[model samples]
Target chain A: MEYIQIANSTPMWIAAGVAIALVMFQALIFARKSYNTGKTIGMTDTQMKSAMKSAMITSVGPSLVILTGLLSLLVTVGGPMAWMRLSFIGSVMFELMAVGFGAEAVGVNLGAGDAMTQVAFASAVWTMILGSIGWIVFSTLTADKMASVQDRFLKGDTSLLKIIPVAAMLGSFGSLVSGHLVALNKNTVAAISGGLIMAIVVQLAEKKELKWLKEWGLAIALFGGMIVAAIL
Target chain B: MSDKRRVYEKDYLPYIVRYGKATGWLAVALSFGPAVVLAVIYGVLPPSAAVFAAFIAMASAVGINWFVEPISYFPIIGVAGTYLAFISGNISNLRIPAAAIAQKVAGVEPGTTEGNIVATLGMAVSVVINIAILTIGVFAGNSILVRLPEHILEAFDYLLPALFGAIFVQFALMRLKLAPIALGIALSLTLAVNAGWFNFLPGRPTYLITLGAVFGTIAIATSMHKREARRD
Candidate 1:
């Protein structure tokens, strides 16, 4: 069979579907367990329901972004592999580079017409699989250990424990924002606009105690900033 | 620890760890299974040399982040959330934000059992939503994207920057003083790198800059926190 035919084959779809189903199953299991745990911990059903609603709303913009990424990947890797990879461990940012490295190793430019052979495509798949396995391996081996590590770090000061995670988030996000802001392009504009928008929305939400504003703040900032940058 | 907290750590966490281990191994298999299937059907395996090169290239690019992310994000999302987020992908873009927003709206502080449960619920909902959108995108294929106006595609480019910016502000508001300090460190390092002032540093300076910002802010914040405690 031709490379393109194999890329979008029925068998590939089945394999991809099975992989996706496993992920969904894992998520459902975890969610159910956590929900039961929440009840034991004295969390109200209203809290759980509100959290689910807020999370669903928060996911819309990012999901749309992932969709954009999927569209781009589909053109290169076809529907099945792209769908499966993106749904499974392949982040939108990392998948392209993994595919690129694989294609380059086989002396082909990915997404170029007739350049990617069956061998090259196989190489790309292998690279994608191999490259991401480290995350699973490291996390599997060490995730349980983190609970103890956090415990040791806390040294009985639970308040300090909260600060550490909050600081980590701040630092990581600060660095990410800086990377985009340095470019002085539309990206920088978007970043600034988005930050400003979020600041305003958060302020309003806090001052008014508006649950809806807090829920929709990120999405509003993201789309609003993007629109503003595009216009400018 | 309180009896409830102890019970959680002793019983619930062990359960989470067990399930996490099982799911982690299963995820590894599922991730690799697709590549194996494609290789067998196509009657082509990537050459040893190609595999080696692709692995090295791809691994070098993401290796550090693979280790760093789980550690950084563990406290915010908890054990079960980490397992699911890492496997499902989109930790930063989708899962983390969803969890964060959910916890916030539910009025649960992160790093607690209730927080972890809320985060898990949020992540599960986000995962389902992401998969649904992706499946739609896959079935729709390129036609939807192909027919999109150029300006809309252009706007998509700003989405990530906007997202990072908004998320940064959310965290920054939590630590008003330290946030700017971290942002300043990252921004300065980013500028220096762009100016070719960091020629001596190996690889993209962005990684180093990010690390520096995170540690630097932590140091500053910790000292300030300690001083405030002493004063109190």
Candidate 2:
């Protein structure tokens, strides 16, 4: 069978499906555990439901972006491989590099139809898997220790504890937004518009006590900016 | 420590650690299993050396992030959230924002046990939403994607910048005075990189610029916060 056919084969689907299923199972287990723990820690049902709603709402725009990435990957690597990798543990940026390295290892260019063979595809799969292992290994080995490190850093200074996460978030987001802003393109436009929209929505939500605006602020800003950029 | 907080930790941390380790290891195995199955079926395993070479090449590019990201994000998401977010992937683009927004909506302070649980719940919800969307996109194939209008597809390119901008503003609102200073540093660094002022730096200078901006903002914000606390 041709390599492309093999890339989209039933066996590949089964393998990918199993991987994806395991992730879903893991999520389910963790969600249940966290929910029970939240209740024990005095979290109200309203808070839990609100958190779940906000999370779902916030995810829609990013998920659309991920789907766009998947579309590009599907054309390059076929459906099953792209689906499995993206759904399981891969991001758009990392998968592209790993797949490229895989193809390069077999002396082929990815997305070049006739160049990719079964052997090259296999090599690419191996490269993608191996390349990403460091993250999993490092995360698994140090996760507990890292938590301990954080605890030691706190030293029971509960008053200042809140600032740590908030500062981390501000710094992280500042860097990310500035990267986009400096592009001086539609990205710049989108980013500025999005930021402005969010600021307005949040201000309104707080002052007017418009609960729904707060809930949908991010989504509105994201899509609104995209629309503004497109129009411009 | 509050008795409730102590009990929650004593009772919950053990289960989280055990299950997190179990699932994390399982995820790693699952990640590699597909490639092994493909190799056996095709009987075309690439040279081990070649695979290693390709892995090294790819890892060299992104390996630093494997360590940096988990640590940088640990304070915001907590241990359980980190485990789930890292395993499930898409931390910056999706999980972190989801966790952050959920915590905000639930009025839970981050770095607290309640905050950890809420963040975990948010991440799990996002995983489910992300998986569901990817599943639909995969199963539907390009039929749906290809039908998207050209303008809409163009707009999708702006989604990420917009999302990041929205996220930045959400956090920036919390510390109005600090936001501009952080933004100024990030913008200046990005402009310097873009203008080729950092030509001496190796690889993409954007990363260095980003790190500078993040840490610089954190330092400035921390000092300002400290000064305010002292005055109070």
- Count of clashes, each model: 0, 0
lDDT of 2 by residue, A113-190 (tens): 547777778888888888776777788888889877866765665665677777777777788888887778999999
lDDT of 1 by residue, A62-96 (tens): 88888989988877777888998888876866888
lDDT of 2: 0.81
The lowest-lDDT stretch of 10 consecutive residues in candidate 2 chain B is: B201-210
Chain B TM-score in each of the candidates? 0.89, 0.89
Question: What's the CA RMSD for each of the models?
Answer: 1.9, 1.9
TM-score of 2: 0.95
lDDT agreement of model 1 with the native = 0.82
Clashing pairs in 1: none
lDDT of 1 by residue, B144-202 (tens): 89899888888988988898899889888878887888898888877887888877755
Task: Write model 2 residue lDDT over B1-232, tens digit each, in one string.
Answer: 7865885578777777788888888889988766866776766677777688788888778776777777777767777777787788888789988887888788787767788788899999999999999999888888988799888888998988888898889888887887788788878887888889988855556666556766676577667767987999
Span of ten consecutive residues with least summed lDDT in model 1 chain A: A109-118
Which DockQ values do the candidates obtain, in the order shown? 0.71, 0.71
